[model samples]
Target: MLGVSFLPLKELFLKNFILVRDAHIEFSPGFNVLTGETGAGKSMLISALLFLGGADVDWEVFSGQRDEAVVEALFVRKGEVLRVKRTINPEKRRTRAEINGSYATKSALRERIMPLFEIHGQHENELLLDPSTHLSFFDRATGLSELQREVESLFERKVELESELRKRRKDMERLRQIRMLKEYQLEELRRAELREGEVVELEEAIERLSHVEALKEGINRVLDLLYRDDHSAYNKAYVACRILEDLGRFDRTLRPIIESLRGYGAAIEDSWRELVAYEERLEYDPEELENMRARLSFLRELEKKYG
Candidate 1:
């Protein structure tokens, strides 16, 4: 009892526990012990306390046809009453706990409730033999428990910061990869010498080159019809003008008709000259066409790859 005037755990209550349907125990000041027959529910009382201390137990502890088992403890310190309750539902296969009648977790029970009292079994001396618990005992003796708790908190914070740093490093690596890829793409586009509307211009050029021979043949036919052949429009217009001019000399009413025929002949001559120049300008270079085709193919590949 650590020199306390009253027991820290004042009372323990159990319900629907194995071999003990309902039992209540009250403790007096100083050390206490329970001694009874082999099946007189003494160990069951200890089990109830262990359950209140957040120890895990199986459904068999619920006894008979009970739906749930409950273990509760009351403590008195500095004239304050603190109550802890633990409940296990066999059907649910889970434990529910409370502190001072409010909801609590098993971790809360272990950290806050279990520290209020100590339970010693037949092998209790093993705790003294183990070296791991020596620091806890020393801290308690020297009143350094608060300092240890602070150090533990700081250590936990350090661990959290380290984990966050690792995550940030991974994110930075991912962003670096993305930035490198974008830079590579920019370099490729720079090398490509892309221009606005370039694809449309290339496609039009390819179409023209594909039909260059057909276009030249068509222009030749047009020239023959307009002026190249002996029965062409220019020759006919010239002959018609002469006939009209001779008629106009005989009759003044034919003068307007002769002038109109001369104008027609002039228009035909201009059209024939323009057609001949256009046909001569049409050059079909296979090597130039192949180069354009290669450039266009490369552009299409770039488009597909990037997309």
Candidate 2:
């Protein structure tokens, strides 16, 4: 199994400034303290330690001095050394950091250093006086990490299940639409009495009926050409017969021409009789057209209802 390690501060230095020439200290795993006279630089040492762990510092306090500060730490986990260093230049009021003698970011150094140290100053006494903060510390001390991990795991599972449920809901909606369409189609088919091949039959019937007026006009024109008042087929054939008979003595072929005219006259007479019979059958009943319109309207209504 693998284990994580934490870095720890080991030594700090403040040279030629702030009522101290040089100071060095080694820290242990347990609690440590600094006690000295007033203006002994004890709080300064603590501030320097805080600054090394990415805490903000007031450069104005060390103004007009050669403000050189260095902090070094030996990080031990299971008795192994991981070193960190930080240096500050008072002239520029800027800080620099290194990890294991390699240059590093202040944020990265803070991440490595914060887990190993907890600082409590006079302000912490006020926090201890607050019941909420005290209760929070109690809760945190009492194995809250396990509860937090469980909550996080459950939250992740809930998110995944919610996504799956949304997909299922979408699928169910599609099925419902399909079912509705089928139901409407079934209802329309039942109400309209539409047979399997009824659409083709009705279309053909409608096409024939829609052209009723044009058909009637064409039939009337044929009837007039065959048996009208003056320019009729019968009158034309009769005139042709008379002409052919007058020329029969001049040419023998005129007899056959007269016979052909007689045959055409008979054919025109039969066609006129048929046209009168068909005209009687070509009557348009509006009720049948209204029934077809109603059937088509019913189909369109069903499409709108379920489409």
Q: Give the best candidate by TM-score.
A: 1
Q: Alpha-carbon error at 7 in model 1, in Å?
A: 16
Clash list (residue pairs), candidate 1: none
Over the stretch 1-307, how does candidate 1's per-residue lDDT look in tens digits?
1212122778888887766678888888657777878888776776677677677776664534445777888888678788989887777677899998889988877666555445445656434564645667788889898798789889879999999999999999999999999999999989999988888999998898889899999988888888889999888988888888878878999888888888888888888888888878778889989999999999999999887
What would the TM-scores of all predictions be?
0.58, 0.43
**Candidate 2: tens digits of C-alpha lDDT, residues 1-307:** 1112234445555554355667667666645566789987777766665565676657776687665767665666567577767776788888788877888787766655543455455456433564534544565689675575578679879999999999999999999999998898788668866566665676766776788899889988888878885888888898889988999979997798799899999988988888889888876778897787677777667657766
Model 1, CA-based lDDT: 0.78
Q: Which residues of candidate 2, in runs, are more than 4 Å off?
A: 1-121, 124-147, 182-225, 228-231, 242-250, 255-263, 292-307
Deviation of model 1 at 61, angstroms: 11
lDDT of each: 0.78, 0.69
Candidate 2 TM-score versus the reference: 0.43
Off by over 4 Å in 1: 1-119, 122-132, 246-268, 304-307
